[model samples]
Target: MADILTVNGGSPLVGDLEVRGAKNLVSKAMVAALLAEGPCRLRNVPEISDVKIVSGLLELHGVKIDSTDRDGELLLDPTNVEQAHVADIDAHAGSSRVPVLLCGPLLHRLGEAFIPDLGGCRIGERPINYHLDVLRQFGADVQKRPEGLRLTAPDGLKGTRIQLPYPSVGATEQVLLTAVRAQGVTELRNAAVEPEILDLIAVLQKMGAIISVETDRVIKIEGVDRLGGYDHRAIPDRIEAGSWACAALATRGDVYVRGAQQLAMMPFLNVFRKIGGDFDVDDEGIRFWHAGGTLNSLVLETDVHPGFMTDWQQPLVVALTQTTGLSIVHETVYENRLGFTEALGEMGAVVQLYRECLGGSPCRFGRANFRHSAVISGPTPLRGAEITVPDLRGGFSYLIAALAAEGQSKVHGIELIYRGYERFSEKLDALGADYQVG
Candidate 1:
């Protein structure tokens, strides 16, 4: 049975909250540890469901993971890792993308890898075709089986130049993992340049991998003979930081998001400023609050890294309900992302989803009746209602919607929130949010 969250609305959340490591980075970093010869120590890890999934997967491969650190530090000993049992690996195939990332490192170490199916946000079809194609480019023989994907690098990995049709984050990580141990130089074009990717590269460099980033979205990696383990700290989660910032805005409260860098979120920070949100930034973290003034509507489009993130759109839309005008949001990432707006509409939000490409390019969700564009008519007062979370970011948006609403709200399927946010309930309580687990 799914866990439910009951939130009593009409209370302003105000306090300082700390954010741990990036969920996106930590998962990939855990998989990256498989490439190291010695044990690697990771600090500032978030105690989330996805991290546990990756840890379990690593233990199945004979890697020793000691996660008893009270401070969220993890010691991963991959030196003794053996061929992982396919059946055990297949169990969590649909959990997250971290499993697919294991294919590369495992293939390099053992010359054969069996990867279960991959799963993540249901925004669109997250195909591993790009990942497979990149693996094949590196001279790995790939075959599809009913159980999972089987990959073999009999002659060992040989690097080659490959270009991605789209800058997919998972595919980019797959290439980085596979190419670092390849025989020669690997050139990857259209690579994702997100901060998480950069952090992964920093970790890889510290582990003796030679990698360089070039203009025109190119990443070149000269495969090293062997990689030594290195201790590293994961980057702060920008999505989690942004979620709390939106929460503060939605509740008309004050919150200091500690441990997150402001420069990493320039696009969101710019929009927050345009929306009349006040903030103060220091070396430690950022503080967010709604200034006593009319909130303005600004145009937003979700794109790949450096673009307005698609993940941040949903919660920001919830905050936009209080803004006194028509706010236009064009989602360029996933077509079906607007589905969350339906639940918002049920909570008294004046949001309209449209199928006609309001922005121009044909989106994956546009072919069906799924709308990619949203027009939020606001200064509409929202009333709380029962809602089910559709995905990770959508769940947090529901929390923001509940906080902004007038009556009590029951948010079902809240367990999905652990995929991203860490210490969410305790942090919410610290902010004076009246929420209880059910």
Candidate 2:
């Protein structure tokens, strides 16, 4: 299949659609199944490439997976879990970071694990240093190997207190997955409490792990004698919901997004209203649309959970280009995330990249000289042009920009978009988009 899309722009996307489980949480929940002896059933899992990657990795490790008659559901049994060949694991885990997180559960099951170098989106440098450090504190012996990294726990893992320099979502997940089954109690400071992370905690709790979250970014996990399985429903994807909302705003369209919850999206929803986009919330989902007036521009800064999500910034930046005034976006999460704005500039958007922290307060990138900030000035009519998808969120941003533009755009590298988005082309067709798959 060709990874290309030719989109004829200028019309708005107006329709109803549904988003499945959070891709960020679903994959981690699938990984959580490895820690269970009984079969764990996960519902509302999105059909995305990342799920396939994690499932393949689990299958290579001898987890028996069977599907139900219902759509988007899986029963994963880790009863006969065994070590997978490093080469096989590497081949299955291409472009995914879940393999590293598997080390703890694999060690608990098999006493040793071999993990290949991780690969993920080109958003920023997401180091596994914190993961390795936390694993070591839990008594796993980490060694560099030719294939990748080998972790062994001969004396068995015992929990220990750990501190994180930054409240990273990945590192926090690593801690939770490893600390759940270790020997004693573990305390972690500066842990991430994102909605996805909290949902992951709920899944682990269902699997018989005792964990508590404190308000001051602290988490305590007490190791249990045994572990069972869980029947869980994953949280709705706020990132995908916000992306669709931005798509509607960018194209001056109306979209009813099913499964978009209000609580998790409160920060994003506030920003949406501030930018002059209107949304109505109900029990099922959210209805987002343009408000028939000039859209306002404002300052936005991305931070950890309870703040504007870093994932929401890219597509909204595209929407901001249709706003009335200047919109300043300070990307404090990933240093090079603003690099994708170049394509919008090519499409006649006035996006200026800057090295300084331009939104509210200075971040770590202020001294690193990375172009981590953007200023978008608009109400400028966009003209579609040839573009290549940069990464997952950035790829969706390209689609929004193309739909909001005048001419046609040939979007290359669209296969990367499937890594996170589930049946995106079908949804585009459902929303009456003028696009063709090549």
Candidate 3:
């Protein structure tokens, strides 16, 4: 039977809950474990579907991982890394984009690698072309196979100068993971300096990698012949922290998110304050709550790091539904992110989509037909509605909406929420949300 969540609405979520390692960084760190000569120990790992997917993929390639500990530590040993059958790879990689990242390390360790059909959130055309081009630039031979893509380092990978059209996080990770063990030096321009990317760099550096970050989005990596194992703690999930903060604002509740770092969430914090959400940050976590007043509507734009993140847009949109006046949101990161707002509209949010950028300067999607912008006129009441979970962020936003509504709401396909959120149902229960899962 499909998973369903029955949410009882009109309640404030008030309590303390903990957030573990980042879903974005933990998977990549698991992949980075494959590059080390010995076993790598990663701490504070989150219990999410993406981590399981990557664990299965690594196990298929003969990487032995021990994650039996309850304290969220993973000990990954890649001593017996060997080629696995493509069929097994496809089955284990089912609808995950993490396999694409395994190409460079596999090629370096085994002279060849195979990546099955990639799958992830249906937000935009996240083409693997940028990843493939980076691999090709690093002297990898790419060939299309029936099941998936096959990459071979016939001449042994060599580092080279490259530039990104946009600072894509995945492509930046590809360059970092690939160039670390390649020959000579690699200079990358227009790189993504997201906190997750920096955390990955830290993991690699612990494994004896030489990497330097410069001003204006430039990253330089000096290749080493070999790398040792690393022991590191992954960063907290800023996205998850922000999501819960927005939930507090939407339902006029108070929430304390443990392990949420203030530095990584500074941009989100600024925006939260502007929208009339109050937060107190300590060394351990941040406490978010509604300020018990009218929320101020404002123009917002979603960009890469140091900007209002695209991942934070959805939940904030739910909070914006209760704010006075109009709130304009320009999503510059993903083109189809605003589509999730349709369910919000069905639940009585006055949201309008636009093809042209309405809140900020013209982005890459402004001239296109994609509805990447949103205008939400709120102080509107939300009622219960039947909804299906979309992507990870969208799924959590739906939960916030349901909790803020006046009646009962049944959310189906809620298993998608587990892909990124770690034990969120339990967290909801801790927050005193009246809900049952079956």
Candidate 4:
């Protein structure tokens, strides 16, 4: 039976909370550990579903992984990794993009690798064509099989200059992982410069990989003969931090988010400021509060990295419903992301979907049948209703909507939130939220 969370709305969340390692970076970093010899120690890891899936995959490949630590640290010993279990690998490949990331590292460690289907937020058609194309360019023999993708590097990996059609995060990570052990230097243009990617690069550098980052979206990696074990702490989760900030605004409460960095969330901080959500940053974490004032409407667009992130758009959209004026949002990352807006509209939010590109260039969402542009008419009274979580960030949006609504709300598929959030139900309870798991 699927677990559900029943929330009684009209309660404000208060008190302090701490965020751990990023869900985005930690998973790929686990896969990166497979590329190096000996044991690697990772600290401040978040206890999320995706991380568990990665740990399981590493153990299936004969890597020794221990999750019994109190602080969510993992020690991965990859020296004994022999055969990659296809059944175990294939089961989770379609659940997250991290499995696809393992393809490069596995091929580097053991000449052949099979990657099952890839999965993540159901926002768009995340095709691995760009990743496979880059892998083929690097001299890896790739073939599509009925079960999954089979890749072999007979002559080992040879580096080549690669330019991405779009700055896809997964594809960029794939190139970085594959090219690190390839022959000669690999230059990647139009690379994703997300903070999580930067953190992964930092971990790789600690493992004795020579890599440099340039301003023009160029990444250069020199092929290294062998990589040593690395011990590093991951960066704080910006997405979780942003979600809490939005939750604070939606409920008009004060919350101090510990372990959250301000620099990583500058774009979201700017938007929160415009929306009348007051926040202050210190060395430890960020503090969010909503003073007694009118919430304002601001235009938003979701881009890759350094731009407003696609994941932050959903939860913030729920907070936008409390704004006094009309709010315009353009989603550039995923096509089916607007499905959550329909759920919000059910709770009395005046959100209209548009087919035409209201934000200039053609977006993936607009290109598809799913509406990318949303006009939110707000200060509307929201009433709670039963909702199902479609994806990760969308699940948080439902939680935000439930928190802001007038009555009781039943949120099904609460497990989806566990894919990224760590002890989310417990955290909500700590914040004085009226929610119970059923």
User: What overall lDDT goes with each candidate model?
Assistant: 0.88, 0.92, 0.93, 0.88
- TM-score: model 3 vs. ground truth: 0.99
lDDT per residue, candidate 4, 1-438, as tens digits?
257988999877898899999998999889888898878999999988888888888888888987674577998899987667778788867677777677788888888888887777887777888988998999899988898888998988998999998888989899989988898999999999999999999999999899999988999999998998899899999999999989999998888999999899999999999999999899999999887689999888888879999889999999999999999998888877887888898889999988656685446555556677889998888899999999999999999999989999999998989999998887897799998788
* Model 3 error, position 273 (Å): 0.3
Candidates 3 and 4, the one with greater lDDT: 3
Best-to-worst order by lDDT is 3, 2, 4, 1
**Tens digits of per-residue lDDT for model 1 on 1-438?**
248988888777899999999998998888889999988999999989999999999998888989774578999999887987778887876777777788889988888888787778887767778888898988889888998778998888999999998888889999999999999999999999999999999999999999999998899999999998979999999999998999888888899999979878988898988998989999999999988778888777788878888888988999998898999888877767878988899999999988766665435555667678989988888898999999999889998999888988999999899888887998988899987898
TM value for model 4 = 0.97
TM-score of each: 0.97, 0.99, 0.99, 0.97
Q: Write the per-residue lDDT of candidate 3 for residues 194-240, one digit (tens) a residue.
A: 99999999999999999999999999999999999999999999999
Off by over 4 Å in 3: none
Best by lDDT: 3
**Which structure is stronger by lDDT: 2 or 4?**
2
Candidate 2 lDDT over residue span 1-438, tens digit each: 579999999998999999999999999999999999899999999989998899999999999988757689999999999999888998977779999889888888889988887888889888899889888988999889888999999899999998999998989999999889999999999999999999999999999999999879999999986789999999998999999999999999999999999999999999999999999999999999999889999999999988898999999999999999888999999998989999999999999999988867537788898999899998889998999999999999999999999989999999888988999998998889999999
RMSD of 1: 1.5
Against the hidden true structure, what lDDT does model 2 obtain?
Answer: 0.92
Comparing 1 with 3 on TM-score, the higher-scoring candidate is 3
